[model samples]
Target: MSATATADLISRAQSGDHDAFRALTAPHVRELQVHCYRMLGSLQDAEDALQDSLLTAWRGLDRFEGRASLRTWLYKITTNRCLNARRSAARRRAHEWDIPGVHPPDPTRLGEVVWLEPLPDALVAGGVDALPGPEAHYERVESISLAFVTALQLLPRRQLAVLILRDVLGFPAKETADMLDSSVESVTSALKRARASLDRQRLSNPDREPPPAPRSRSEQELLATFVRAYEAADLEAVVALLTDDVFISMPPMPYEYEGLDTVAEFCARIFRAGRRFELVPTRANGQPAFGTYLRTPDGTSNGVGLFVLTLAGDRISAMTRFEKGVLPWFALPRSLPARGGLPGSRP
Candidate 1:
């Protein structure tokens, strides 16, 4: 992990030693992915950008004269790729749906913030292979929290990059300015604006601790109860687990139903359709999630939803339902077998 060792590995990697290349790059992969995610909020988009950046790095490896650390060099490539991606036709197509809710909610309660997305803490917590260095790992988890990322997404792209590089990643102002191709003063100004925007969006009820490591024992029990209640179409039991201010939002389709009563009504309506759900548990954004497959009225299971649960203390505070296409990202099947009996039925 020393500078000299890293330099040697980079040299070998450039010379086409695949193992050496991996050794040089392995330690920084998670962080790079996170950087990509910050630039592109969609997980899928981040993965694509990371792949593009890696390929570019490989192709240009021989040209790396090490004026900057290998890490900084890779980051430059990543940031550029993300910037290009943000200008692509596909990105343009995606933005058409960014404005959430065709029929705006009563502004008195939910406010106009739509376009919200979930981020699993595992992705941001440096994942399973994070480096052990304290300075490198410090506040990394907090830096990628849903609240923080959402605030970041609201900033102009250049400002977002400046803030992340200068504030969260602690890059020197000179280096950050160079990355954005702006003056140090401009970088400082952008960082200030970005911080102010984030301050305005800070959660009113911030957790006393870092968001509890996702999927704790309590979360598991609550998710189980949710699965049972939802699959059984038991409105009362399901309502019991929701916070008074629970919010449900389905993205790529902008209607946010808020409060336990409204959320319960939505669930009840779905239940009355005679469509049952099969919940497959997974983790995203450091929270409990289920790849939700729905059974048709005719009793055939088909992928229809990806449900991510957000818990504040013991009660469910939010449920985000993503489209079925997201099933594959969570490694879920397009469809499942229909239930032979009611939920909790023994084989």
Candidate 2:
């Protein structure tokens, strides 16, 4: 992981050693992908950008003269690629989620009321390579949560990068300025603007209180109950775990379902249709998650999507379901076995 070691690996990789290239870059890939996600807000886009950055780095390896650390060089390339991607025509197109045969929930139930993307908690929590400075000052998990990321999307791109590089990623002001190719003073100004914008936004959310730390006993208990209720297909039990004013949304689709009553109705309808769910536990944005699989009466298992739960106190405040294509990002299978012993499940 040292500069010399990286240089040697790069040399070997450039001389036709594929294994060397993998060895050199494998350790940083996961975290780098997460960085890409933060910049792009789309998992698919992040993966594509990461691949592009890697290829660019590989092809331009000869030009990389040790002026910066290999990690820093790759980061520069990756960040530039993501920023360029954000400016592309594709970014202007509104991304939509397609959930076959299901209507989107009403918008009244959404917490922050944004059409933001879903990210795996494991990806954010597990990938923390650039943790510079005091650990005490860094609330890494909280900073990367869905709530925080959505808020970040509201800021100007440069301010977003400044805040992330300085606060979330813990880079110093000087280093952040260097990365963004701005002066330290400009980085400071951008950070202030970003913070002010986020503060104004947060003030609008009446329920936006500082959440308790993750992995507390209460959080664990809540997640456990959710898993149990979901696995048993117990609609009522699931409703019991939700806050009275809970919100449910399936992104990439326009529907939003709000309140305990409405969410209960939605769940009841699905359950009444004899649709059973298999909840595979996972995490996203520092929140508990389940890779949701639907089982039809015929016993076929189909990949419904990913359900990422946001916990407030001991109750479930929000549930954001992402599309099936997101499964690969978390290393989940495209399809799973149905509960009723059916082969070739739709998933």
Candidate 3:
């Protein structure tokens, strides 16, 4: 919109015109939500923070002096809100295993960031454009991956804010400093420390092979093969598709299994009771995912969990399982009737 039109809209909004306020902020809501998701690492929390930020903006609209673009100003509000949420002690806690009659193998280690959540592909496609700016070190896709986000949650809150603003969102150092009410030198120092810490966490490794292009024939074939093997409970077939360094983690539950052998053993224990699953294909965080349903004796399948796969080239490198509570976020149903007595297949 032209400057004059925006000024008029701002004037109307500042005069308590709710419609004018919505019009002025509608263009930015999705991207701002994504920014919150990156900072807080939970879709629900992001939505909460976004709502809180918008409310704060609406209440404080008169203070918007038009010095920065409205989008940047919205981001400023959203980011600070997320930082406050992160600093709170009530962040989602790790969940204990509640699956009846299923005992998993001992995990290699306990995951520290258990509140990590997946971002739906559709939501991301709606909000994110191309890379934010020239200073961005990570591509839009890599930046949102579970590995990257998990690593982000480990940083000091200020360092996290600075790194995301300077590197991921590509905000200039001075602008980031202004947003945090810190000096440029402070922002620069925080970003430098954040980058080194993140590299040590292996958020991105230069030598790693990228996954197959989204929805490419190769990706489709790999996903299909995985689903078939997984549903059939063919441990050997499933294990064949894994990279040697593959790991499996279930959040909410802190258990994490690393390496092909350990992950294979965990799968073996899960299937030891002849348990079978019905897999529904989906995508999360730009990677292939599935809604896993446990087959029941009553001729129906019950939603059990969501599994998101991370690929390195054609091999599966990581699998992250979320509790069934996340099913609705992916638009997956909680249950499905038997496949007319035929073998279950992808819907």
- All candidates: TM-score: 0.80, 0.79, 0.96
What would the per-residue lDDT of candidate 1 be over residues 1-347, giving only the tens digit for each residue?
A: 98889878988898899899878888788888988887777777788899999889888899998877788888888888888886672541222222222223332233222444555545656742444233232265556655466567667878788777766777788777766678989988887898788778654356422333555776677788888888777889999988887777666565668777787777776666565677888876656788877666666678877887777766788787777767776667898766577554524
Local distance difference test, candidate 2: 0.73
TM-score of 2: 0.79
Model 1 residue 42 CA deviation in Å: 1.4
TM-score of 1: 0.80
Report lDDT (CA) for all predictions: 0.71, 0.73, 0.88
Candidate 3 local lDDT, 283-331, one digit each (tens) = 8987889999999877699999999999988889999999899999989
Off by over 4 Å in 3: 205-207, 341-347
- Evaluated with TM-score, which candidate comes out highest? 3
Best by lDDT, which number?
3
lDDT of 2 by residue, 111-190 (tens): 33233566776667557645655422337676667767767766788897777777777667876777778899998999
Residues forming the 10-long window of minimal summed lDDT in candidate 1: 92-101
Give the count of colliding residue pairs in each prediction.
7, 15, 1
Which residue segments of model 2 deviate by more than 4 Å? 10-22, 92-105, 109-117, 121-126, 135-138, 203-220, 228-236, 257-275, 331-347
Question: Of the pair 2 and 3, which is ahead by lDDT?
Answer: 3
Candidate 2: 10-residue stretch with minimal lDDT: 338-347
